[model samples]
Target: MEIPTELSSYIRVLKLASTPSWEEFSQVAKIAGAGILLVGMIGFLIFAIMSFIPGA
Candidate 1:
């Protein structure tokens, strides 16, 4: 795409977007944190199981 078109598109997006409220931000943060924790726990569990196996 051309530079002018790309810039206009970015400007349009910026005009349409608004800052999230505290409640919305907090909810997203909580969900993202939970996801991270869940993935970490799953990885740890896999590592632990592998360590106990005879040959992994």
Candidate 2:
């Protein structure tokens, strides 16, 4: 079986859309980044509390 030229072009575009892009990142970057930051902060806080233990 063979794919048509137009079908191939549509597949190519579909493939590109399936990948992340800077414009899409720009829209959600802050939310994603903040979640990461929140996680890091919680991790560091846990680490700091652990370090405060006498023998940890």
Q: Please report, as a residue range, the 10-residue window in candidate 2 with the lowest summed lDDT.
A: 18-27
Best by lDDT: 1
The sequence of per-residue lDDT tens digits that candidate 2 reaches over residues 1-56 is 45698899988999887666888878799889999999999999999999999888
In the range 1-55, model 1's lDDT, one tens digit per residue, is 6999999999999999999999999999999999999999999999999999988
What's the distance in Å from true for residue 38, model 1?
0.4
Q: How far is 29's C-alpha from truth in model 1 (Å)?
A: 0.3
In model 2, which residue pairs have backbone atoms overlapping below 3 Å? none
Residue pairs clashing in model 1 are: none
On TM-score, the leading prediction is: 1
Off by over 4 Å in 2: 1-24
Predictions in order: lDDT: 0.98, 0.89
Q: Which stretches of candidate 1 lie over 4 Å from their true place?
A: none
